[model samples]
Target: MNIHKISAATIARTACLLLALTNQLLSACGKPVLPIESQTVEQLVTAGITTVAALVSWWNNNSFTAAAIQADAEYARLKQKGE
Candidate 1:
């Protein structure tokens, strides 16, 4: 084989061996290679506050409260007519 061909083959074989060794090492450790991104305390607190506010607003605007108020007004009207 030519000198250039021999050198290229050597580099290719070395790269493949390195890749296999790295994979084996990673598997043996039983952990992920990449780091996980973590949320900040401020972000968690803000999310909790936003969730609570949304729930409260939804409850206030729900049909049950509106229906109750409407029933009370109707009852008042009936009482006025009876009087």
Candidate 2:
């Protein structure tokens, strides 16, 4: 299984995406745009936790898929060799 490590850059990118989405949703509701950094400390922590959870979920799903693909390839190789 090729489990890749998540980088700071990845986290930052996801955070930015989440921020943009939040802003868009708020704007759609006739609300003022509030950037993530402008939020209170509690809000910021909540956002950070949310972002991390999303990233972890994504990583877990991808890792499982990768492992499955790797296993399939190995099985194919072994079967071909046996044949």
Candidate 3:
């Protein structure tokens, strides 16, 4: 059986959820408040978004490269006939 490792982005988002739940529990109990940095959530969102954008960019580049190569090959074949 093959097991897929969970991604960092998923872990980060899970941590964000845990942080929220922890704070809620703490506040309800009247315990000492913990400091929750907004940066953690912001960074996680940025990481997830940038990862998706990069994958899309990579796909576009690979397809464009393949098409360019095919066009070059066709151009060469036509040039040979014109000679």
Evaluate all candidate structures by whole-model CA lDDT and list the values in order: 0.75, 0.82, 0.83
lDDT of 3 by residue, 1-83 (tens): 99999999999999999988888899788762575468976998999999999998887635358788898788779999995
Global fold similarity of model 3 (TM-score): 0.38
lDDT of the structure predicted as candidate 3:
0.83
For each candidate, what TM-score against the reference?
Answer: 0.30, 0.38, 0.38
Ranking according to lDDT, highest score first: 3, 2, 1
* Per-residue lDDT over 1-83 for candidate 1, one digit per residue giving the tens place of the 0 to 100 score: 65544588899999899877776688579753432335664787889999999999987734468788898788789999995
lDDT of 1 at 81: 100
**Candidates 1 and 2 compared by lDDT, better number:** 2
Q: For model 1, state the Cα shift of residue 83 in Å.
A: 17
Instruction: Name the top lDDT candidate.
Output: 3
Q: After superposition, how far is residue 67 of candidate 1 from its true place, in Å?
A: 11
Best by TM-score: 3
Backbone clash numbers for all candidates listed? 0, 0, 0
For every candidate in turn, the CA RMSD to the true structure comes to 21.6, 13.8, 9.3
- Pitting candidate 1 against candidate 2, the one with the higher TM-score is 2
For residue 82, model 3's alpha carbon misses the true position, in angstroms, by 36
The better candidate by TM-score, 2 or 3, is: 3
